[model samples]
Target: MTLHAIRDCIHAKKVWDLCVPKRWRKHFFLTQDVKEWVRKNITIKGRLEDFEWRQWFPIICHNIWLAHNDRVFQGSLPSHQDTLVQSRACLAWSSLVLHVSNTVAMPCWEPPDEGKVKFNVDGSLDVTQNLRGCSGLARNHESMVLCGFLYRMPSGSILSTEIWSILWALKVAWDRGFRNLEIEGDCVVAVNVVIEGVGEEHPDLCVVQEAQMMLKQDWRVNLLV
Candidate 1:
């Protein structure tokens, strides 16, 4: 039933006829084995108009299956044109996502400004094992390690762990007499809470307030995710 909807249905045939080239149709339609048919369609690379056949092929099959369901269950018949248009839309969206993923640059670590120390902190949790820990390190402008610490927690929520890590890192830096400092943590919630103070009723208000106090003290400290 599934195979019939994707490959042998009327709408599926129409899409294949419009996309598959004349020279390829013989081998393409002759593959009766499901695995072999799918393998050939994806690996035998070619293009249909402006779309790559590998990407467009599965999209067309998916849309065809959707139309089949709509017609069968909802009693709404879909034209071949609608299925083709939907397939094209899916292909365009997938292409845009792929392009963005390939072209966009990933975030990289940057050293602190001259005369300032950078503290990078991160927390980890293993829910199944009920384990949590956090580690932080401070580096000077020239990238030399100034101070660092690793502490394990008996039990705590993720947010509390992140907040505690920030608090600990700040305390460590201040104790080492680094007044000009920049703090970086992968946890956005913790950094944002410290920058933009939380309300009184917030769940993690205690730790957040403690972290806020450390930031508000007489020193220059910048925080970011």
Candidate 2:
């Protein structure tokens, strides 16, 4: 349901809070109560293109359902750490999907110079789940597939997946007896990281560093774009 429609559901019986016993709150457990519950109507105002609500509401609901299921089936309530991990995973997936859908597309894959393979990597976050997949394909100048691979990763930001795609593609090319290669991706931020061999201080720094280190390995003058 749209967030506006959920106002009644959030306020009437506080279905979200039904499971949290008063004793739990007496201990001052932090709660996710529809993000600012009040007696007045929620405006739900934002920029037309902004997707904050769509991205965040699902995380809250997913965590709540997960906690419920764990308590019911496993006879165990999720810890704060568990809730944070699940919620972050969901948030990462949402961010990835929004970035991919909004990414501008190239007309079609272009062939690189002869003797050099064009490695194109694309990443898409699974919209309905906390998973991300990246596809990397190496094609010769004749549009022949030298090698290709897809890697499924746990929930993370799109930049991390993009960086991983590059790393995996490089390994695939080296294994397939290709040396000269041109790596390409739609994410300018990720591409720049490969070219500069560095990334800003962020959670994705580890993967970015790995990809850069892989680039230093003997690969016969690979180009990043």
lDDT of 1: 0.76
TM-score per candidate, chains pooled? 0.51, 0.50
TM-score of 1: 0.51
- Residue-level lDDT of model 1, residues 1-225, one tens digit each, is 456778777777887787779999988878788888888889877888667788888877777777777788999756676567556645553454466579886465699989999987777677987888776767788875545665678877887678878988888788778999898887898888777878888777887787788888899998877
Which residue runs does candidate 1 get wrong by more than 4 Å? 1-106, 201-203
Highest TM-score against the true fold, candidate: 1
Poorly placed runs, candidate 2 (over 4 Å): 1-106, 197-201, 221-224
Cα distance off (Å), candidate 1, residue 100: 22
- Ten contiguous residues minimizing lDDT sum, candidate 2: 39-48
Q: Against the true structure, candidate 2 has what lDDT? A: 0.59
Per-residue lDDT, model 2, residue 201, is: 63
